[model samples]
Target: IPFSSTTKYQISIHAMEEGYCLLAMKGAPERILARCSTICTESGTQEMNDEMMEICDRACTELAEKGERVLGFADLVLDNQYTKEYPFCAEPPNFPRKNLRFVGFMSLIDPPRPQVPDAVERCRSAGIRVVMVTGDHPVTAKAIAREVGIISYEEVIEAFNINTIETLPPNLPFAKNKAIVIHGAALRDMNDQELDRILYNFREIVFARTSPTQKLHIVEGCQRLGEIVAVTGDGVNDAPALKKADIGIAMGISGSEVSQQSADMILLDDNFASIITGVEEGRRIFDNLKKSIAYTLASNVPEILPFLAFVLLNIPLPLGVMAILCIDLLTDMLPAISLAYERAESDIMLRPPRNPRKDKLVTRKLYFLAYGHIGLIEAMGGFFVYFAIMAEHGFMPMQLFGLRERWDSESVNDLLDHYGQEWTYQNRKELEYTCYTAFMISVVVTQWLDLVVCKTRSNSIFKQGMGNMVLNISLVVETVVACMLSYLPNMSYLKFYPILFRWWCYSLPFALLIFAFDEFRKWRIRKYPQGWYRKETYY
Candidate 1:
């Protein structure tokens, strides 16, 4: 059966009725057997022979022994067959108060996971607070909450006496003004009074005597104060509240089918530890998305640098529209996709949650790093290309030259002829070498710089030993491929100037120089305080 607890009860009952021989049952084993056998009936079976009677006797003895050892609860089914025989009693037995040592009873009567406490504490460290809400009595709730490290053992588990909210303990110190133990009756009747007080004035609060409706109300009230609520539920009654939360977390293992359907995410193990896993996943997703935005903006700026320079210097655009499309689609796509899979930085969860209102383009310090460093690298590369040509001409080169350095009178016309040929037709294949080389140098070096910038804030900037071996290897491979690509032959039609195959080899040092400059910038930003690099305007 999907509900193992219910299945165990049914199985145990059948075992008891069949007179199955008992071996050893204690603790969880005993509880499980008892719960399973609760529905079993030995009433109309054959008359108890010696062996049968002995089996029954053993079962009875075991039940009594274990009953005193654990908190046992059973559903009392009344025999409606008999009438009340006109007997009336004036007073009922008064259950003792001190005997109520149960701090909290979980509504989830399912067996507890042994690791809930450790998992909860880890979440607390990640800046996500946990507060337990259950229909169980205050004593039982408190016990579990303490065991799970959600609350301390010294605090009293506050409970309202029945439906009356006013019956709560008077002159309560408010336990840091958070009412760590706010009963469900109070939560439902107070119209967000305790909730608003807690959200505004308290650090944390634990709720008890909560029904599904009350749970939903609490979630809504918390959201009103701008708190993002992740509600976890696994039962039929929990479906409505789970649907209402900002992030609905459902238990996949023990959760009801309805609850799982309503939830945004289902925890595979039904362990509280899985909740922590989900939060980590959310953080990683957000981080990778931020990286994508940073990478796209940085990448686009560099690709467009030659064009921007052409506009500024009143020169013809070195790259045509098709060339821009080719580079954007081919050269830039792979590395940007690679950035999406960048491994989580060591401090991903160590920091607090990013504000939802924070803009990926504007608010974060990473954006500044992306624009400042990336723009500088692009401009430097373009300047070198322009300077290399100018130096070759002695002043300015108006005449176009082939790979063999022979002059062509119609320089622009010859360049257009080269652009319209087979080399251009298969630009992805031919320029695969050059474009990829440039892109490789640009991205890998920039990302490494990005790593430095990210780590410096955590005082990790000084830790040069922390390097990603895989990223390092990928960068080496990219550099070697780019270097070898420059020497590919048969390039006369591709350019008016001599194909500086050796320039590909030369670009490597510049790439490394870019990396060093980025690191220097990070250091300068920290060491120089008010002055480092010039702030460039960006969207």
Candidate 2:
């Protein structure tokens, strides 16, 4: 019936053994009740003494320091037979089963995969913390943590070994600034209040000799102090804390069914770098979303002002409905879409993590900067083009006032200019189309200038450079598309015609004016951090 005649097993598993059993119950300080064995040795059944106990302890420490999971074994003395209490693996139904000899320990090391260190560094740059919890010797846990950048590799190894500390500091637990390694037994002794203090203050921490319940305790303690927690696990034991974390990340390839069921997300490759990539991508998307909104709003003030002025002042319509549609739906769309391809700000990782309570997507500063300042400027520039064109073409700005009613009359084609020149319906329509083309060119050309300014909230666009390929290509595409909308003949839907070469020359100064003005505004904001302009307009 027996495969090995000399085998006699004594085992107790689950939380009580996996978490609490120490030294294989051989040298542990528990009461003894039975003495039995199936194997006999020549050296008087393998004696348990001080030297043998030392060897077991040394074996555990060595394995742990090398990041190994050490298992314990014990020899049972054969003097009396005992009834089996636990099934599968049995032990005598009594405390500290009698006459146990300390058999040496064995270990397993699951070497960490490559790229984990770089991923951890990225998390640190983004202001995320990493903590290690393991049911292994403190030395072993500390060793692995150090290898992974969780603990500094340059840290003196001697400083981490607590027992070797011939002189203890006043704050015994936190003497080392680089890292603090806690033993599981010592952690079990600490109350939640003490745990919270350590977690709140320490920059680096390693929790060793932890049980399944201790890991749960660590997650709960961090949460109680208002920290967002994310737990990673692959075993059934990790299920409880995985479910408790704000974001539970499970290893897909190696994870158990229960862990997969509990996790908020799973990593198919099981590489920690994926998490860092996610953080980077998420931040990039949020910044681009804000950029697109700001860019879209910046032009709306100018587009809508033409109608408002016509309704109130009754001036001849400077911009018709078709012209507005060409600018809004056709010419301006590409550049606004291009804003979505902007790269992350240069200091995106260097800045402190944004405060969730204070930072926001839209704010008074954004509104004032986008609508009240840039938008107003664009509106004024558009109107100036209309005024300049009319003034030079034999009509003063004053003469165009209150002309909306007559300008719209189908039969009124002999409208006279300041030079006493009568114009037929066909001739006046050509002049009107010329003005419309000038207005369209003004908005399109000016918006390209605005796009450069919109690239950064504060920094110089030249300093950031134009390496974003999507945005660079979109710039080329927008230029071509806008040219077609304004210059190509027979654009009946847009009521547009080819703008004169002279109008292009006229627009150069206005576009330059917008760019120089924004540059000056940026300079003042940078030079005077507390200035009112920077405070209200630093979008």
- The numbered model that scores best in lDDT is 2
Clashing pairs in 2: 64-140
Highest-TM-score candidate: 2
Model 1 alpha-carbon miss at residue 521, Å: 6.8
Residues 1-539, model 1: lDDT tens digits? 12222122111111223333212111222233233233323343243245643564455444433221222222222233222332222234121111111111112244347777778877777877787876544545655676667775464535353333344343335434333567665675675665565555544557765777778887888788887889888887678778998888898888999999989989888888878876787776666666556655665555566566456654433444443454455444554455445556556566566557653434446556566666556546544554443334332323222221212122322322223432222332233233333443444344444433332332233453445454445445544543333344543233212235444343445456655665666455445545634222111
Where is the poorest 10-residue window by lDDT in model 1? 97-106
Runs with alpha carbons beyond 4 Å of true place in candidate 2: 1-55, 77-99, 153-178, 183-194, 220-226, 341-346, 357-360, 398-433, 456-460, 509-539
- Per-model CA lDDT versus the true structure: 0.50, 0.69
lDDT of 2 by residue, 212-279 (tens): 78889999999998777889888777888899998898999999999999999998989888877777
Per-prediction TM-score to the true structure, in the order listed: 0.63, 0.76
